[model samples]
Target chain A: MTSSTSRAPVAAEGTRARLIDAALDLFTHCGFAGTSLQMIADQLHVTKAAVYHHFKTRDEILAAVIRPAVEDVKNLIAEASAQRTPTARAERMLTGWVDLALRHRALIGLLQTDPAVKPHLKEEQNASILLDQPRDLLASHLSGPGRQVCAQVALLGIVGAASTPELRELDDETLRDLLLDVGRKILGLRRPRSS
Target chain B: MTSSTSRAPVAAEGTRARLIDAALDLFTHCGFAGTSLQMIADQLHVTKAAVYHHFKTRDEILAAVIRPAVEDVKNLIAEASAQRTPTARAERMLTGWVDLALRHRALIGLLQTDPAVKPHLKEEQNASILLDQPRDLLASHLSGPGRQVCAQVALLGIVGAASTPELRELDDETLRDLLLDVGRKILGLRRPRSS
Candidate 1:
């Protein structure tokens, strides 16, 4: 009887995670605005009520869907920030960001470029803080009067191009190599050694 | 009476053009899926029926809205394809593309990164042709086995970064210079002379 009770909550948690996963896939392909709770339910072969039981609204589902990625980015920023030198910090940001972008390619694209998703992202606390932290990290090592804009371009360009459909056909290793190479060039950092 | 009759068609044309413009604005900010006929009509202070008189569906309005941009891109491709040398052709493409991206910054963002809009863009006749021509042009000039991926990164990265909110505050001239500088770097071209 005790084991049955414990398994019940675990089963519910599993279903909730499955729903969030299905919603993320739908949101990636159908878009945040285009996806409906009914569609999410259908994707998981459940009723709309089942979806509502977990997420009260589409926005709630969206928040849950993006929460892990946002946390990952914040964690990335934290680690990169801990580096001693500006160059090391920037490199940490660069390599870490490229991996994050690759790992969450579609979700990153949807979050960055989707108009409907932008406002929701902005609602996350300290969105500006997240933006400024990386800009400052990158700007410290980058040269020229246009360093601010250049930093933004390097960061945005790497993730943006990584998520593009044309590059989708390229394997992750190859894509990672190309992105790191171009990202280093954009930031005026030394190329990765052949060794 | 003759003058009034002659002017009626012109007035209709003016309203039609205004509706398309307003729809484009709505689509850029609200997204293709989030936008509705009523929103477009309300933007122009017209009734839904008036919008229906011109467009049977939101898709029709979207087609009308994006037609000009697609035609402009096609024209740019034609002009670039005419250059005798690959270097000149790539240079023309790079310059023309940056200008085009800057001109239609938000619209390009909506068209490229929005998942809901991808299928619609693919439905355009010869979408693959438009993609291949630029890849071939860029491949010819870019050195390395990853030329294809590099070419796409340069093109997509420029437009994608140009459309980002961070770079939105940078003036067009500044954005253009930054994009051209980075584009040339990615493509392995010589830097422009300061003088």
Candidate 2:
């Protein structure tokens, strides 16, 4: 997904965009349960009704905030799945997933740690299947009993690493490179040679 | 730390143990917010008053259930802190931590993912200091800007890896060795020579 900060102002200039931005800020700092429509409105200097006009519920706002990142992940999974070789798929998935995570670092942390958001992210219904598809695809690339476990941990490490506050100060390119380097080691993949 | 399953029956025999066991099961499966004292009591076929005798509230039961694992971590950190060399400390911390996570696999997942349990685990009062000590110690072992980020992600990877369901089937020796190997690589530590 494109960095929200880098996106053109037009996509982020609308009332809906404003609400999502305020809600994300509040949710990240105060947590999903701690944030309310009134809080979002207060932060935006608007009425709760103004916030409600764009999103009927907090969950709706959360879904909106997470949609872009989720879509990016879905697209990454699809692209990786199309690759014929497991090695090719692993390499592509690693680079794509790391880029997605670095681009949306805060959102990744919230998705992994926030309880209220977690159920929504892992509901096992239509949207939840999207979450599992990438993991299952990763598993297919691995062999042996430990392979699944290694793949899962490697993915967690990369995403968790990208989302760390200390790592946030690193430029995107540096952070992406370090994550890819460490992630390849975790997954037992060979590091790419210099171009 | 020893696995609760491997501990003496005395530690697992009492009404308090039964209550904690039931609570962990419910909390892990249903999410901490979804599980109640009454549900824990129901699981054990015990009266609510009986459950209350051991734990006045759900949070109390969670604290008791988490206490041993936390204590194990505290001891490990203390031992690592006493080591003179960063390499020695990293080695001790990594191996000790992997062992602890394997011993308390299910609990680590619950602590990391359960939002209700999270605040209690992270309370910055007296107990929360214990939580930060190990991380701070880990950080001291690494040098440079990326050190903190690498340390945090490496620890997350080790704990997350230890708790995976697929890895649960691997024997402890195998899991421990794999975790140490991958963990050393994550931290940029040199591989140990033959014993």
Candidate 3:
């Protein structure tokens, strides 16, 4: 599969991007149920037909909006799995996951919190598998008894921390440092010796 | 303000309690938007009018469902605030908060994740105040610069960890211990000297 960077060329510009942007803002604030295609079009000062030409339905718009982030996750899992050791894989996955989550904090928050967005997002073919792939991969690298639970909780902590409104004020770097610090501790993984 | 235990006698049993219980289950599983008063009544094998008599609207039913937990938070903050030292207060608030969170994991998850329940829950008088009180209190007890952010993230970690599907399999005692363990580490609070 192509990396997010490579796929960015196809869906990274024009009215498609604008619709995605507007949809995200509305979805984040008003929620999926609260937002309508007309609202998205109105926000962009475009006709409904203009918006409809690119995406036929609200779910299609949502699919477009989340595509890049999901692709990045797919790429992260692929890269991490390619690592030779479980430790290396876990470290890579943790850092990569944190980076992705921070970069798209609002989208991540919506996905986690908004019920309307959730069912539609899940309907995407392979969405569940894609979502669980990294989690399962991360669980494999977690050591000791109850590592599965530990891995899951550790991930929950990282994702939850990143999505919090209170931490929104912290710059990406500061937030990343704190999240990685706590996340590593939760996962029982020490800092890489080389770092 | 009445404690959760003291107020239990008021709305603890009978139709009110049953309605709240059924509403919470439907809300947790089907979400607030997906669940209707009819469905709630159906779940309890009662007519919609029976449910409506107890709760005039879905929002009112939601209010009842969340009231006990919200009250418990209020009591937790009040109790924690009575403590003299920052460490003591933070420890008390942390433990009590975790205990309450574990006890009502599904409701807490719905409150945190479901958007439909949020606005209705927020409409209750003092809802925002009740929600922020514990957070503000927790921040006060947390020391050093950046404590607000730290306190917020720590609470998120605890709530998020407690609500995790993976952690659901573990017994309540084990979950509480693990949550407290990570919660303390996140808040920068050293374990209480006695414990």
Which one is best on lDDT?
1
Candidate 3 chain A lowest-lDDT run of ten: A1-10
lDDT of 3 at B153: 56
TM-score: model 1 vs. ground truth: 0.72
TM-score of chain B of each: 0.81, 0.75, 0.81
Tens digit of lDDT per residue, candidate 1, span A1-195? 111122234465676888888988898888788999999878877777767778889989888877877888889889988998888888888888889889878777666545567656545543445567776676668777577766766776676667767668888998898888877877788864641
Q: Can you write out model 2's per-residue Cα lDDT over A1-56, one digit (the tens) per residue?
A: 21122222333247678888888889999999899989987887766766666788
On DockQ, the stronger of 2 and 3 is 2
Q: What C-alpha lDDT does candidate 2 achieve relative to the native structure?
A: 0.72
Candidates ranked by DockQ: 2, 1, 3
Shift in Å, residue A31, candidate 1: 6.8
The i-RMS of every model, in angstroms, reads: 4.0, 2.4, 3.3
Q: Between candidates 1 and 3, which one is better according to TM-score?
A: 3
What TM-score does model 3 achieve against the real structure?
0.78
When 1 and 3 are scored with lDDT, the better candidate is 1
Cα-based lDDT at residue B13, candidate 1: 71
